[model samples]
Target: MNRKTLVLPAVVGLLAPVLAACGGSDSGSSGGDAIVVGTTDTFTQLKTRPAPLDPAYAYDVGTWNVLRQTVQTLMAYPKGDGAPQPDAAQSCGFTDSGNERYACTLRKDLKFSDGTPVTADDVKFSMERALTIKDPEGVFALLSTIDTIETKGDRQVIFHLKTADATFPFKLSTPVAGILNPKDYEKDKLREGFSIDASGPYTLKAEVKDKSMVKAVFTKNPNYKGLLDVKNDKVELESFPSADAMGEALSKGDIDVMARAMTPDQIDKLSAKTNGDINLVEMPGLEIRYLGFNTEADSVKNKAVRQAMAQVINRGQLVSEVYGTQAEPLYSMVAATVTGHSNAFLNKYGDPSVSKAKTRLTEAGITTPVKLTMHYTTDHYGAATKKEFEVLQKQLNASGLFDVSIKGYRWQEDDYKTKEQKGQFDVYGMGWFPDFPDADNYISPFLDKDNTLNTPYVSNKIRNQLLPQSRREADRLSAAKDLTEIQDIVAEDVPLLPLWQGKQYIAARDDITGSEWAINSSSTLQLWELGRGVKG
Candidate 1:
C-alpha cells in the first residue's frame, strides 16, 4: 500500500476503556451525575496546554478521549457524517484550481481562554512551531513540505502549499493542525509538557502524579468560535493504574467509564450482573496488530524461511481463541476499514496448512534449525496477548520447523521499543492506530525505513518508487490503490505479516450518557470535555 498513507502520529495505544462509544455524542450529556469519564494512564507533562489542543505533537487517543470537547480542529465529523464539517473556522477550503492554495477565515470573535486573539498569525505560528519542534519521530514531518503561509488579513489566512496537496486541508482538520496561542508555544520554544493552556471548553483543571489523578472544572472559553461537532457542558477525567483499580473504582461509583481489554474473568463478572452499570459497544477499529520480522534478523531474512514461518500459524484460530472473537483475522497489512485492503498473502499461501509450511521450508533448502524470539508490550493489550504468544510458540514448535521462544517487556517501563530495537527478538507483536481517517495513515509509519517499527523492515522496492510514488499523489483515496498493492508486496516479502484487525470497544456506565468515539486514538487519557447531565 502507499505506506505513507497510514502515518500514525498518535501514540495509538491498543484499547482503552473510554467514556465514549462508537458514535460520539452530538450533545454530550451523561445521565444525572457530572460526567467523570475514567482512564488508565497519567501523562508525563502538559507544558504548552493547547489553545485548541494541537494533535501534531502528541495526540494521545486516551487523552483526546477526554480532551476532544475542550479542543477542536478546523473541521470535524458530526456523527454519521463521514466528511468533516465546520467548527472553529467560519469557512475553509481550497481556492486555487491546483489545490496548492488553501484559505481559512476566523469567525471574528475567536479568543483563547487567556483572552488572546486566535488570529491568522496564531494559526501560522502553531503550524510552523509544530514543525520546528524536535519530533524526530517525524510525526509532524508532513509540515516540511509547506512552501509558504501568509495571513490574508487579520481574520483570514491563506496557505500556499509547495505541491498540490489535496489532503492538506484535511490535514488541517486534524488536531495536529488545531490553532494554538503563539505566546504559550513561543515561550516554551514549542516544547511538550503538562501545563496545558487550552482554548477548548475544558482545561486540565487539576493534577496529581500517577497514583490518583483528578481534573478540575471546565468552563467555556468566551473566545471559542464554534468549530468542533461535539457539544458538552462539562466533564472530568479520572485515571487508574490497572483495570482492576478501574473496576474497583467503578464499583464504588467513583468513576463513570472503562475502555475495553479487561481480563476474560473481568468481562465475565461485569457481563453477568445486569446492573446496567456498564455498556459495551463494538465498532470496526482503524487499527491492526501484526508480527514484524526484523529484516535484520538472519532467520527472518531468508524469503523462504519467512514465508514458512508466516504459513505455520492459523490467524483465524488466534483471533477466536486469543481475542475471544473480540478481534478479526487480519490477513492484509491495512485494516478492513482502510479503503484498499487486499489479501495478497492469503491468496499466495491459502489457509496455512502444515504441509505448506514444510513444503516452503523444504523448498528453501533450509538446513539450519530456525529459532527466534517474539516480543510484545505486556501492559498494553491484555492478558490474552501472552496466551496468544504462547499458543504461537506451541504451534510453531509443533511444526518441528521452528524453535520458537517468547519474551515480554512491560510497556510502562522504558524497554518498550529499545529492547525490541536492539534486535533482542526476531519477531514482535505491534499495533497501528490511524492518525487521521485516511487509509494512508496505515502504511506510512511502519514501512518507512526510518520509522520506529521499520528498524528491522527494509524493502527497497516498497520503500522507493511504490511508497514515494503513492505519497506524491494528492488524492488520498486514489493513493490507496497503490498502497493496496504495496501491502500485498510487503506481505509476500514477509518483512511484516498482518495478524488481526481490532474492533474498538469501550465500557461505560449505563447512566453516563453522551460518550462515544468512532475514531482511532493512539492512546493518551485526556480528562477535560465530559459533562454529567450538564450542557450549556
Candidate 2:
C-alpha cells in the first residue's frame, strides 16, 4: 500500500464553530446516535484520476480509514493481536504445502449495502479490477503476487500465486484487497466521485467537498453482513487543516474524537489534564519515518556518500528534538516491534560521529563539503515535519563534510507525482505506515526493483534470493535469519536511512467507548468500535 499522507483544506477556522453548535450531547442513545470524528486527513485527488475512495484506486491510510467502514475485505484483522481472520469468508486457508494456492468459502447470504448478494465472483472481480486498472498511485503492487484468481461457483474463491507467499492472507486483509460490487464499479476504470456501494459495517450517506473533502457522513448499513458488530448508528469524519485545529475542535466538543495528526506537545498537554472530560488513548503504532535516496541522482548516487551521510546523522537527537516522547529512534527498515528486527545501522555506524564520516568520505577519495539537496512535503505528514527537516539540515551541515539544502512541496499536487515518484531529489523524507503488520510488508515495498518509492533500488540478493526464501517459510518467525541479513545489506548500501518509529494516539471524550480499540496495528481505523458510553 502507499504511504499515509494527509491533504486537508484550510477550513478548520470555519468548521469548528459551526460543528460545535450542531454537535451531539455526551450521553448515549438507546439506538446508538451519531458522533463526529476529527482528523487532519482529507480526500486526495490525483491530476489524472478521480478522488481515491474507489477500492481499485485507494491506497493511503486516510482513504482506507473510510473504505474500511464501507468496503469489506474477505479477510480482516480483529481488535486484539494483528492476525487475518475471516470477515466475508466463513473459512480461508492455503490448499497447498507451497503456500501458493489459497482458497476461501464465502459466508452464506452476504449482501452489499445496496442489497445485492456478494459472491465469489465479486471477490474475483475486485482483485482483477485493481490489477487491471493498475493506477500509478494505487496499491496494485501489493496484489502483484496473485497469478490468477479462480471462482468456484458462487461461494468459493481461489488465489493462485506466482511464488510461495505466507504474507498473502495479511495482504488480503488490507483495504487494497477490499471487495467491490461488479454492478457498481467498472472493471477497467476507477469509480468517479465519492459515492460507494459495498458490503461493510457502514455506508457513505454524504460527502462535502470543496477542492478536497471537508466532511464525510456515514450511516449503519442495515443490509451489511460482516464480522464487525458496528456500535454507532452514524458517524461524521471532519477534516482540519492543522493538528492545532483538530485539537481545538476536540477541546470545544465540536468532535467527540480526534483520530489522528495531533502534535506531540498537544498530546503531552492532554495527558497532563486532571479533568475527567477527556481521555487519551495510546496504542503501539507501526508507523515509521525515514529518508530515502535516489540512487540515480548525482549527489547521492555513490554508495560511499550515502554511507558517509548515514554515519554522521543522529537518530536519537532527531527524535528527542522534534518528536519528544511521541517517537523512538528506528534502526531497521522493519520496525523494532516486528519479529527479527535488528539494529543493523546502529551496530555498523555506532553513535553519530563526524570523524568517522570524514574518514569514510576521505578514504573514498571524495571532495569535502559535498553538496546535497533534501526534499520533503509541506502538508502531508504533520506540522512537525518542517522542524524535523530543519534539524536534519543542521545535523548534516554541522559535520562539515556535507552542505545540505531543503525544499518542500505539496504532497498530492506536486511532490508525490512530479518530484518523489520521478526520483527528482537527491535525498527525500517520507513516512511508511505498513500495509500489514509483518516484516516483509516493511522491507519488500522499499527494496524491490520496482519499489513504492520510485527510487532505483535494484538489489539482486534481496529481490531475487532473500525475499523469496523468506516468503517460502510458513512459520513467519522462521524467516528471521534471512530478514536480519536483509537489514545488514540495507545498512551497508544505505538506500534509505531509518529515522524514528511513531506511536498511535487517539484523543476522545471520556464518554466515548472503544477509543483504545479504534485503530489496529496496520493503522486502519475501525470506526465500528467507536460509540458513546452510557451515563451513570
Clashing pairs in 2: none
Instruction: Write one digit per residue (lDDT tens) for candidate 1, span 326-417.
Output: 67887777776555667777888888777888888788888645887788877666656788888888888888888989888765344455
lDDT of all predictions, in order shown?
A: 0.61, 0.80
Q: Model 2, 414-501: lDDT tens per residue?
A: 7354577777888989888888877898888888655677668778999999999999987777888999999999999999999999
In candidate 1 the C-alpha lDDT for residue 408 amounts to 82
Q: How accurate is candidate 1 locally (lDDT)?
A: 0.61
* Residue 369 lDDT (model 2): 96
